[model samples]
Target: MPIEWIDCKPISLVWFSWREPLLYVLFTPWLLSLFAGLLITALTVVLSIRLSWLNRSLIVISAVLSVNIIYSPLATQWLSVWLSSQLPQTFERAEDAPRPVAVLLGRGAKIGRATSRKAAQLLNDHKVEAVYVSGDRLSTAQRVVKLGAPAERVAGDSCARTTWQNATRTNAWLQRNHPEAPVLLITDPWQLPRAAHAFAGQGLKVMPMAISPQLNSRTRNRLALRETAGTLLYRLQGRM
Candidate 1:
């Protein structure tokens, strides 16, 4: 069952542009750790001329371990599972239920296409009333349109640059037109948790729909690390 109520604490939107950059710098655990390890390794190499061999070895070992943990598949798998654990293990909506409005969270070309494809499928199946592409609006909307969705049936926001913006901006429109309609929040599986939480925070009834992309281990781990950081950041900001 979809979580119907979650109180998202109000946050100041002042200086909102800084949120995304700061999130990666301050809240991204693996990224910050990577930078720290690289810096330590560089400094150790430079100071090895003066430091004792034992101390130098210890620094190098610590740096390597810190960097290696993020690349480890087991570590990534654990984090991925824990992150998505909050999402429903199973979901079912009655066929007679009101049709949901599809909301595709903006992303890169590959994910945009995948998400758009899903939205088109829902539209084609008459499962959704309409499709709204948040964030990268033009690109995503174009993809959905190209996939055969009627131009009039699809709409979007080109201004949303972050997940928070995606929810708030989309809600700005939804609250007036589809206030009572259930939202089908669409995005990559790894990002669905945060995306769902963000949309729900806006007081929209959200049903998560994740589209899995074909990704290599390296790419998948990279995305997982980023999402783990993003989830932490949103929690800190009281957005999730």
Candidate 2:
């Protein structure tokens, strides 16, 4: 049920591997941008050969596109910082109050590891009472347990294949188990906003916790462009 092919036996296990989706999400935008630039440049060259005046117009368009592509890294960094700023870094923890639960959005091993570590630390610090992991639930739960989280305090749901599903399933679980509890949502920096919106839409009080620290310029741009495309696609599908 973890996004694997049902009939194919040989490569079905590949679904458990996290690299495929990560690579797709991280590089798809850059690949599309490169393809578009090449196509546009070829078109511009063909147009300029016949109409000299059109050359200026095409050049301007290309220039603008190039600038946007080049500026993606900074834009992504700014967006990440801005999104992170929207959530509180510190929350009041009182002895008599119910402890907040940490919700880890599953994507890959690295993200799961980071979230697990954070969850463990928060547990140690008495910041959260329990940890709920979404995506490939069995594996994620195992990883969190391996990272030192108590098995009894960790819960997981494998049915969530997307951010929306993650939110909805987790919301349902919370409603049944810990209604009105504050949730500390954890995910990649680029996905913070969409994930937060999805969780909030379910009437859950979500406090986003982005795991990644500062990314390099090039990586930031690439991630930013990819996130932008992803956001637009989700919007078109009415997912976000």
Candidate 3:
């Protein structure tokens, strides 16, 4: 269901959203915290010797407690909202002066296809000269052509999985091909803040055409905790 259609209550929806990947992404920190907590409990027992078995027994208890404890500030609040808030956004086609190059960042083919359709709406009103689709649509090139953009106008970047790279790559392509054209930056709103930063930093005069939304304080606050935990973990592992 569209997020705008219903105000989401976490309690009613979390169980229903309990697919493995979502669980893994949201509950990843709980697992790590639990593991660390158990190791600490084990170390304490090792030092005493008298309570070695007791410490081992306490591991499961500590792990469960750790999972539930970390669950409150992080998982339900920030991570869920961070991920789910990036659903598809519908934008009113830019109608004033022409945005000759519409830069659509791709999370997938249908995503690009949907965004491309929006670009076509802009094109119909002569608002943009062409669509710049950034990401791997794979076989969906045919779909892009089907949406009314000429094949040469659809620029694809298969390597970008992050917004920073997307902005950099799209900017490079624009400089080479359509340097003077004003751009329509199309993407989900939750990620837009960082994206706009990166794109504008690249000196693209961006007119944003948002696809989804950034959740409210109720949601962003909840989701932020999860992302904070995740960011910490990523730092520790040198993955960030």
* Clash count for each candidate, listed in order shown: 0, 2, 9
On the 0 to 100 scale, the lDDT of residue 218 in model 1 is 71
User: Which lDDT tens digits does candidate 3 get at residues 1-240?
Assistant: 111111122123353355445546454656656566767776767776676576666765776576665456454445545544433232334456445687777654444556666766676566677666665443444455566656665555555555556777778878887886767877654444445555766777766766644344444443344344434443465433
Better of 2 and 3 by TM-score: 2
Whole-model lDDT per candidate: 0.76, 0.68, 0.57
Candidate 2 RMSD to the real structure: 6.6
Question: What are the C-alpha RMSDs, in order, of all predicted structures?
Answer: 7.3, 6.6, 11.5
Q: TM-score of each candidate?
A: 0.77, 0.69, 0.54
Candidate 3 wrong stretches, greater than 4 Å:
1-33, 36-100, 213-240
lDDT tens readout by residue for model 2, 1-240: 121111211224454487456546346655545566666667777776675756656675675476465456556667666555544333445568677889987666666677778887887677887788876546766666677667777787766666777788788878877886878888777777777877877877777777874456666666555566556666788755
Model 1 C-alpha lDDT per residue in residues 99-186, reported as the tens digit of each score:
7889987678888888899899889887898888876747678777778777777887666767878889789867766776788888
Error of 1 at 70 (Å): 0.5
Strongest candidate by TM-score: 1
Poorest 10 consecutive residues by lDDT, candidate 3: 1-10
Instruction: Sort the candidates on TM-score, descending order.
Output: 1, 2, 3
